[model samples]
Target: MKKYLIVGCGFSGAVVAEQLTKNENCKILVIDERSHIGGNCYSERDPNTNVMVHKYGPHIFNTSNKKVWDYINQFCEMMPFVNRVKTVYDGQIFSMPINLHTINQFFNKNFNPKEAEEFIEKQADKSISEPKNFEEQALKFIGKDLYQAFFYGYTKKQWGCEPKDLPASILKRLPVRFNYEDNYYSNIYQGIPRNGYTEIFRKMLSHPNIEIKLQTKFNESFNIDNFEHIYYTGPIDAFFNYKYGRLGYRTVYFERGEEIGDFQGNAVINYAEENVPYTRVHEHKHFTPWENHEKTIYFKEFSKETGNNDEPYYPKRLEEDLYKLELYLKEVEELKRYTFLGRLATYRYLNMDQVIEEALKIINE
Candidate 1:
């Protein structure tokens, strides 16, 4: 029987382990530095309020891929969810994605879809035929007022830099809907696991052929020669001992608190002003609307440049970082008996669905 070592018991590792177990001849050993599974998506019930809280941060499972959705559904019952995010600017709350309702409310006009589109086209910076950075992209897309109100401050705070310094590709991910749709994501399948993400991992890794070891960190000490293959879901730079300079990443710090009643009616609220220290606030109870909770638990998210010891959340793929990532890829290609999987391994920002889809592809290949 071939023995395999998988690092990080998150969705990537867990899914790969589950898929590999079908072979029956493969024995899998999964490890994570954290005490729990699900990696950043780890969720636990709050002792004070008994509300299910995302330990690292909020994670909503939204994917258009039926295979990916169906695969996760096998482990836990996914309750229907649609993230309707709001933005607070100048003391006024507005719908996200610059929808028709948001456009009408922001300018105090009852313009329809055609009129709104024409108005925004005029607002856009036509002079910039090609956008080089995030600021240029926003100026060309939504114009000054909408960009400053919704994206400028939030982007600056989230990336810990001015919008102009970041790539325009980042802003392209956020769509501008002309209709009244306030649902944050457009995916066909969207929901949260009723039993929490940790439960999903528990059920996925329940195979008799797999063994899980929590609080175990992957390092140089591990005998790579022992396992037939190794699947690493950790930072690629860290795996190579940072032979090349560290790839840039942004980390988040959460300020958690419990409240008697609903703190924020919505699950997520963006603070779109540079003066505001935190980027967004998340209400845990709102995540699982299927269940009722007397008290609510929330988190105020703050973003910072990832430090050596800090847990990396988002990859900062600037020009220099991409250059470093290329060097790491070269190193990865030279290595044998190893495969890098997941967002951290690939050094790219990926949502929950994308991560699972990629892991499934890797195992299937």
Candidate 2:
């Protein structure tokens, strides 16, 4: 039988292993530095409240792809979920994604969809025909007042840099609506697994041909001669031992607390003001609304530069980082026996759906 070695037991690694076991007569060995199978998406019930807590903050599985939705549904039941995120600005609560309701509330004016659109158009900067950076893109789309109130402080904290310093493509994913649709994601399929995310991983990796080893870190010295091919889903820079330079990344840490009844009364609430140390607060109970719990557990999320000990959450793909990535890609092209996939391996800020799509596509290739 053909043999293969896969590093990192996250979605990328799991999806590949699950598909390869069915497609080929092969024995696959999967290893991860962490003791968990789900990686950052790992979730378990809190002993205190019996609520499913997302260990690495909130992750709502949302995707427009039908194939991905059907594939994920095979493992676990996805509970219907709509993420209606709210933001606290200047002691006032506002609907997120700057919808029609948000615009009226922010300006203290009752305007219909058409009126709101016209007003925002006037507010937007007319001088700049094209936007060069994140700040300019916001100013062009929503104007300075709304951008300053909604995006400025929160973005500065989340990215750990001025909005102008970031690329314009970074802000393109966010949608601005003219209607009262408060669903945070515009995707057709969106939900949280009925069982925790970890359970889904357990089901995906249960094939007899797949052998998993947790807490086994891969390095340059690891033998590769036994396997036909090696699939690496870890950080690209780490694979080469930082031969070029360490890529830039932002990591997040959480402060946890428990409440008697309800904490935030919502899944997530962003603190838009700069004075607030944490970017957003998440109530774990709200994620799985179908489940009942007397006591509630919440986490305050704080974002900062990736430290040596921190697990890199968001990739900081500035000009310097992209330049470093180009050098790494050149090195990747020369290798024949290795395949790199997923967000960390490719060094792109990707959503969960995108990651799964890439994994499915890579395996077929």
Candidate 3:
């Protein structure tokens, strides 16, 4: 019988394991450092409120690819959801993604779509023919006022640096809309699973050929000679024991609370002001509006530099980080028995659909 080992049982590892099980006379072992199967996308019902709380943070599955969409739906029923995000800036609530409604509210003008476009053109920095960084990109696209109100403080808090220090490509895609459309994501399919994300992972890893171990951390000393091949979804830097220095990452910690009736009355609300501290407050109950609950649970999420003990969330991918990543890739190329996959392994910020697509491609190859 063929044997395989998978480290970190997130979507990437779980999808690969499930696909591999179709092979005859094969057995797979999956392990995660965390006690749970679903990595950051883990969700469970609160015993007190019976609300499905997004333990790591809210994850709404959205993808433009029909193949990816259908692939995930095989595990669980996806409740139709459209994320209409809201932001609080200067003591006012406005629709997010800086739509025409947000534009009118911020400028205090009732300009039509065409007039709004013209006004934004005038507001944009005319001197900047090419944006050099994130700050310049925002100013060129939405002007100083909108940039200051929406992108400036939030970007600083989330990334742990000034927007100017970041790369221009981060904001390359235009973030504003000329119409009143405020759907946070422009994906063709968007929803939260009816049975929660954990169930989806549970179903995927339940194949008879697969065995799982929780709280099992993999390191260089772990025995790998027994397995035919190994799929690692953990951080690439940690795999090399930080020999080239740790790649920069920003991690998030949450302050959770429970309230009766409703807390924010919405799934997510961004606190755009730097003075507010927390980047966003998410009420988990609002995520599943199809279910009724008297009490709601909310989390105040704060971003900071990832420490040794922290679970790294977002990859900073600064210039120095990229240099270190290149070195790690070189070392990875020399290893024939190990394959690195997923967000932390690749050191790239990927959506759920993108991660699944990458995992499927690897199995196909």
* Steric clash count of candidate 1: 0
Per residue, candidate 2 scores C-alpha lDDT tens digits across 1-365 of: 99999999989999999999989999999999998899899999999989999999999999999999999999999999999999999999999989999999999999999999999999999987888999999999989999999999999999988999999988875578999999999989999999889998999999999999999989877888899998899999999889999999999999999998899899999999889999999999999999899999999999999987789989988999999999999999999999999889999978888989999999988
Clashing pairs in 1: none
Candidate 2 wrong stretches, greater than 4 Å: none
Residue 139 in candidate 3, Cα distance off native in Å: 0.7
RMSD of each: 0.9, 0.8, 0.9
**Per-residue lDDT of candidate 3, residues 1-365 (tens digit):** 88999999899999999999965579999999999999998989899999998899889999999989999999999999989899999999999989999999999999999999999999999898899999999898889999999999999999989999998978868778899999999999999999899999999998888999999989977888889999999999999999999999999999989988998888999999999999999998888989999888899999999999999998988899999999999999999998999999999999999999999999999
Candidate 1 per-residue C-alpha lDDT over 198-280 given as tens digits, one digit per residue, 9 for 90 to 100? 99998889999999999998998977777999999999999999988999999999998788889989999999999999999
lDDT of each: 0.92, 0.93, 0.93
lDDT of 2 at 210: 97
Clashes of each: 0, 0, 0
- C-alpha TM-scores of all predictions: 0.98, 0.99, 0.99
Least well predicted 10-residue stretch by lDDT in candidate 2:
167-176
| Candidate 2 residue-wise lDDT at 110 | 96
